[model samples]
Target: MSTPTSTDLVVGARPDHLISPHGVLDLRGSAGRDVWLSYPFDAAVVVCGLPGSGKSTLLRAWAASATVVDPRVTRTSFEARMPAWLPYASYRPWARLRHMHWLRGELRRGGPLLIHDCGSRSWMRGWLARTARRAGRPLHMVVLDVGAPEALSGQQARRRLASRRVFALHRRGLARFLRQVERGGQAQVPGISSVVVFDRGQRDRITAVRFGSRPS
Candidate 1:
C-alpha cells in the first residue's frame, strides 16, 4: 500500500490495513451506537461531504476493496493537461463535466462501488438510487459532518481550495439532506438502506471501510 500523505490527519489509520484503537469512536457492542453485525457486502456506498472535507483522505486509507470514484483523480489529470499558468478557475466547468461523465459510466457497473461525493449536487445520488433499485443492490452512505472551519482546515492541508460560493452551496445542500434524514427519510430516500453520520472526531476514529459481516 502507498504511504498516506501528511495531509491525512487521521490517527491509527496506517499504511497497513489494520484498525488501531484510535480509529473507532464506538466500540463494538457499544450502546446507543450503530454497530455493524452484518452488511449486504454487495452494496454500493456513496460517501458525501464538502470539498476538502477529508473524504478523499479517509477513503484513501480505508476503501481498498471497493472501486473508488473520486474527483481528485480527474482534477489532477485535468491540471496536468492544462498550461501551468492557467488557473484552475479557468477550466472548472470542463473538469466538472468530465468527472460527471466518468461517474455516470461507473454507475453502470455491477456489484459494490464506493463513490466519493463532493456534495454540490443530488442528481448522481438520484441516479444511483434508481440504478440500485433496478439491480437489487442497496445504496448506503458514510457522510462527514465536519464544520465549515474544519473543512477549510482540510482544504489548506490538502493545498486545494474551493470557492466560498461553492462551499456555501455544498453546506446548504448537505444540511438539507441531513434535515431530510431527521424527518426519517433514512429508508424513504431512494435505494438508501443505511446512513452513517460522522463528525471530525468520529471520522478520525474510522480505521477502515468494510462491507461484509464486520468492519474491515
Candidate 2:
C-alpha cells in the first residue's frame, strides 16, 4: 500500500473527512485532544476512545480507506458486532480472554486487520501487544483523546438514550480505560510507537515515538 499522501493527512481534503462511503470519520478531533493514526496498511491496529469519542467513526473510515487502497485487505469491526458472550457483565473477564484468542488467530491468517474498541484498557492492550509480537506483526494504536466531559455528555445524550444498559456499562468501562491510559501515557503498552492528538482546532496531529517511549 502507498503512503498516505499529504492530502490524505489533511482534514477535509479527502472526499470523506469523517465518514466516507468507504470509511468512518472521527469528529472528536475538533477538540484539542490527541488522535492517533496507524500506518497505511498495518497488520493490526487498536483504536482507543471513550463512548462518543468517535472510535467507530475512525475505524469505519480506516476500513473504508483500506478497502479502496487494497481490496485484498479485510477490515472488520470486532467490537461493534460483538459476539453474545461479550455483552453480559458477569462474563466479561472470560469473554475478553476468548476475544483476544480469537483476535490472535485472525492476525496469524491476516493481511490487514484492525481492532476497533475502547483499547484504553492497559491489560487488554498488553495482551494484544504480546500477541502481535508472537505473530510477528506490527501493532499500532490510534488513541482518540476526546476529553472526559465531552465523552460523558455524548454518551449520556446520544449513546445512553439509544441503549441505556449498554451505554451505562460503556460509561464505567470508558472511565476506567481513560484513567489507565492517562496514568501510563502509552508507556504501558509495548509496540505502540506513535500517537496522534486530535485537538479542538487541528484535526490531525500525528507524532512518532519509539517503542516503549513515553509521549512528551
Candidate 3:
C-alpha cells in the first residue's frame, strides 16, 4: 500500500458546528459543573490519548458534525518533530514548545486552528492552556486515555508489519510514547475539564468510558 497522504492521515475536520454519530452531546454539559462554554465557534479543542486509543477514530467521528478545518486554508504548520529513531521522545518537550510558539503566533494572527495528533502530556497541555488564556481564548481538551500496555502493544505490532524504514523509527517512537504516557499519568496536569477513557476490546473496538465530573 502507498504511504498515506496528509489528507489521508487527517481523519476528520473541525466543522462550523459540532457533529458526531452519537449525536450532538453538549460538551459543556459534560465538561464539568464549573466548566463554562465561552464561544462555541472559536474554541480550541484538543483530542489527546495514548496510541490506538481511538483518538483518531473519535476525531473522525466528531469531524462528521464539524466544519472540517482545511489545513491548506489555515496558516498552520503540522510539525512532527519526533526524532526518526524516537519520534515521541523528541516530540514531548521540545516539539511541544515549538508548537506552543507557533500556536501563540497563530493566535495573534487570529489562529491557524490546530489539531495535534500526539499525546497531550501535562507540560504540553499546561503550556497550551497558558498560551490560550494569554490570548483570551478558551482551550478545550478532550483527553482520550487508553492504558499504556495496549497502546504499546499496538505500536509494536504495527511497526513489525510496516514495510518502510519509517516504521522501524515509529517503533522506537512508540517506546518513547509509552514512557511519556506513564510519566504523564504520574504527574497529572490541571485545567483539564473533559476526559474520555477508551478501553480496547476485540477487533479494535473500544469499550466507551464512563466519564464523570472528575477523572476516573
Ranked by TM-score, the better of candidates 1 and 2 is 1
Which sections of candidate 3 miss by over 4 Å?
Answer: 1-39, 60-97, 109-114, 117-120, 157-193, 196-216
lDDT of each residue in 1-75, candidate 3, tens digit only = 121111111112222222211211112212211211122344556655555445555555445333333221222
How does model 1 score by TM-score? 0.72
Q: In candidate 3, which residue pairs get closer than 3 Å at backbone N, Cα or C atoms, i.e. clash?
A: 13-68, 14-67, 14-68, 15-66, 15-67, 16-67, 19-65
Q: Quick one: best TM-score, which candidate?
A: 1
Error of 3 at 195 (Å): 3.7
Residue 21 lDDT (model 1): 15
- Clash number for each model: 1, 18, 7
Alpha carbon lDDT at 205, candidate 3: 30
Question: Which order, best to worst by lDDT?
Answer: 1, 2, 3
Q: How well is each residue in 1-216 modelled by candidate 1, as lDDT tens digits?
A: 322222212322223332211111212121232222223566677777888778988778756667788877889999999999999889989998898777666666654578898644677677767876766666777778887899999989988788899889999988887666656444435566666556776666666666554225
* Number of the candidate with higher lDDT, 1 or 2: 1
lDDT of candidate 2 over 1-216, digit per residue (tens): 222222112333222122211122223335432333435343466666666666555555556433212111222233445665665455455555666666777667645666766654566667777877777777665556666666667666654432566656666665675454445545544565433334334423332211221224
